[model samples]
Target chain A: MTDEAFEQALINLTETMYRVCYAQLRQKADREDAVQEALKKAWEKRRLLRDESALKPWLVRILINECHNIQRKNRRVIPTEDVMPPPPPEDADGVMHDLILALPEKYRMPVLMIFMEGMNGTEVARALRIPPGTVHSRVHKARQILKSQWEEAQKE
Target chain B: MKQFPDDLSRAFGRADKEFVYQVQCTVKKLSEEKRKERTMNKKIPFGVVLFLAILLLAMGTAIALTIHNWKHIETAMDIAVENGAYWEWSLNAKIRLIEAMAEDGLAVSEGDMAALKGDDLTEDEKQELADRILTEQYGEEHFIYYYTIAVAEWGEPQTWTLEQRYWFFKTEREKGLYLDNSWIDLLPEETDLTRDEVVRIAREAVRSAYGMTDEEIESYAPNVSFFITDVCDTPRWMVEFYTQGEDGQIHGSPYSVLLTRDGEVTEDWENLGVLTPAQARLRQERQKETAVDVFTMRGQMRLQDQNTVFWNPEGGKHYHFLADCPMVNADKLPLKELPVWDAQFGLLTPCPCCVSLQDFWSLKDKLRYDVGSWKYPGPDWISEEEAVEKARAALEEEGCSPEGLYPAVYSTGALEEEDRYIVYFDALLTDPDGFTGVDPIYYAIVDACSGEVVSCGESESNG
Candidate 1:
């Protein structure tokens, strides 16, 4: 692809890329590092994209892999004391953000892609390399968890 | 189908401008790599390759000749150096080598090397020369020595296996040449402490110093290593323990102790002071900068209201802001939150160690409480208003404007043992709308009893 075309594609998908990356990695530094690494890898392997339509899913897959690599390396080292969960937000709107983040890793990404990134079920499956049925099931399960947490918070 | 809430969609808009800058930087770097690759693809002509080969060949030949000539001179000196020019040249080379080695902290005396010269030397003379060099260097009675001959092959030095010999020197009776130094045994197995004993001594020292229980000591599993220091003139064990400090950093503190063969501690152990005051201040500054960067990336102006102010109403003595503050016990979960008015009215003092509060209230006329003990005068100290005023004054002295900052005050109540109350306040920078800025939150601590400043500095958070 030409440099101008590549830059345009990147600018159009910046928000989607960031949401996907932030959903996987919590820390700001880790998110930035993962996105930069993913972009470089995508540029290096740009020739492999036979069709321009496949670019978004391919980039998302590379980014998810980079985030996983960072998480794996972090697990091997002794965690510093500052690696605590972000403090809970006090506002009503922020409750959903925290609940989605609190969801288990397996369900969090699919929920984020469908809801936050506005991707369809098939697109999420393609990006994650999973069956479309699996993506639907994960989204359903994540919503159930969020519903229960929301209900419990309301009762309190 | 359920969809993401509007708030959740808006949260995605919180992307930092720094991310875009980082992506552009990466693209620029990749483009530079592509340009370099294109330049490198150009082919080199055969004439250049042939010229480079010829140049390398000439350099190799010169190096080989130099090595060959040096080897011949050294061999002649070993056998018999009757020619005056050759003798003087060999002696000068030997002197230069010894001088260079001495400058590199490996001393070799000229007398020792001179004694080994001359091919007519007897075996006894050679043994005496080796003994003198070893004794001068190691201050030991016995030593193992070896010498090898190097032969030139294709401009490279290869070991001459047939001429290599080893010698062991102790007394005149034990002095003999062999094929290798392996024949000489140097292990002082009986005089050294066992590994298990060293570990036990190190563990005991750590436990006593830190007041740690047996379970806590076992879980930490301090690392112990053995080394021989001349101060002890024997092997001693160095023990290091990794502990979480008040500043939320894992610090390794090492202690060195000398132990006898019988596992008795012969000398008092000394703890290595790792972090100085300047180092602590530097670390705090770095952490504050990192926190500011993170806040800016997240587009957050300040911490949650209830999250920043922590209080234990039942204890009713102190108020804390930072979750990792050292004054609060690690096991104390779910710290209670208090309103700004209640926290200020109760006259609760802030922790000195965590908040870096200056002791504003001196306890000269008031009763003081001794830490870790209940043996002291009653808790009599300054009022809440006085503590707050003193803290504000301290921040003002540090060039903080009250009009542009929101002040959060916390305090530790009067302790009979300490003889004073400690007040701490965080001077958070805010715009006209009461929104916090990216600047560091200044903190000040004061002694409530005498209204004297105890300590003052900046923390990573508003606390």
Candidate 2:
């Protein structure tokens, strides 16, 4: 493919990639960071993806891993600014977004792949290199967390 | 969570665009740095190879001379005796011993081990001595060939066998080691070279050997031609000459030749530098064309067919082409004829680099397919008559009202808004210092389509 065509492919993949990252991390800043990091890695290893047909899958896989890595690192750094009142109701839906970020990485990854990207549970399992049953359970646990968090926020 | 954020998709899209843009910018910067790094890496390997070659050549010449001269051999042997001969020896230890002893004033005859054991030598010395004896018995050629081989293998000097003798003589003559008086030793009669009669005879002998009638060698070489003119006890003939385009004259220096006595070449007959006038002129005519060198304007280029087009990629100006010009890969055609079709056929998809013939054919094949139609347009041929008509129309369209328009105009086969191939030209210019000097005028081709020059001519501007 021509260099211009390859660039167009990158453009097409960017939106889906951003959604996957956002679903996994639940923060606009973190999703953007994850997308940028994933795209950079794909660009650096572009030669390995000479088969342009595989570029989207390749980029999506990388974005998922990068999201997981960022989540793991964020969890290790315990927040010190604490004992404050609940976050303000700015973008009301932003609360669900914040709760998604707080969810365990395992659950968040499957929900992001299944809901945001509309990938099947089996595809999510394959992407994560895990069993389809594990992916189904992760998605189930992610929905439970979101439902519970939404109820708590409503009560508040 | 909290009704699960409906506007998350919109935010995601905006963030995605920003992220892609940032990543693209970073990739562009990294690409430039990586290109520079690759260029530097390419030069390092070539430079290392060149340096190693030069070092080997110098070492070989030094070793060869040391081995050939018995005095150096004696000194080396003394050092070997004082120290251990095979201190740094390995698989070739046996060979080194044979060669060293043969050089150490040892006769090296068969069964001469008993004769060689007069001094209590180290294991290295004993081995070297034994090897020398074996070489003496088995090897021939007065140990000269052995020295040559040793120099070649160890020192790696770059010179053909035919040139070695001349190199040796020239080097020795320059050092004032060889003298003209040595030639008198080859004289049968009692000839006093200093006297008038002997000097006349010596001059006569030189004339006869060089096939010159009465013309002296001095007027030939140093003054006019490639002839050597260095004065020494031993003299050699060197003839040199070249053509002067301004004067339209063929000039040359005289040929220098060693004057031999009784047909025998001695140390004094080492060099007879200079050439006769006739020989100088002959050499001049031969070298005249070769002396013409063209210097190129680095990165500045012009196409042959297009005059107004010029480019300088280094200067950072790109003039978009009116139409893409395809440079034909002339090598693909048979020697009998140039590849006229490709030369005249401009490619629709012109890359920054020259159009490869294989790419042209591949493109042509793909033009009928859906993928090919979307990527590359085809059929870039302009007929001779149609091109002429177009040129006339273009000239008329400009309202120049010229008496005649050249029918040989070309079309850069691109849409009206598409970029055209820059016209590039190769030109020759006289050196600023003038033609009498060593360097010649520069030659170069400028790409006029874009301001960037594609290729440049050879440079001989070093004054």
Every prediction: chain A TM-score: 0.84, 0.66
lDDT of 2 by residue, B1-463 (tens): 2354433333223444466675566456445534432221112144443653464455545545644433333333333333322222232444444446555554555444543454566654665565455445435211223233334333322221212433333333333333222211111123422223333444455567666666553222121111122233222221121112233332432322233433332334213322234443343323432222111000012122233321222321122121222222234221121121221111111112211111112222323221112123224433333433343344344443323211111123233333222111112122553212111122222222332322222323212
TM-score of chain A of 2: 0.66
lDDT of 2 by residue, A1-156 (tens): 334555667777666775676567644556665665665565554533334544554567777777776564332111112424234234334655666667777787677667666677645654675667788888888788887877888888
Native contacts conserved, per model: 0.18, 0.09
Runs in model 1 lying further than 4 Å from the true structure: A50-52, A76-83, A87-93, A154-156, B1-7, B39-463
Give the best candidate by TM-score.
Answer: 1
Q: By DockQ thresholds, what CAPRI class is model 2?
A: incorrect
lDDT of each: 0.48, 0.39
State which candidate has the highest DockQ: 1
List the lowest-lDDT window of 10 residues for candidate 1 chain B.
B160-169
* TM-score, cand. 1 vs. native: 0.31
Fraction of the native A-B contacts that model 2 recovers: 0.09
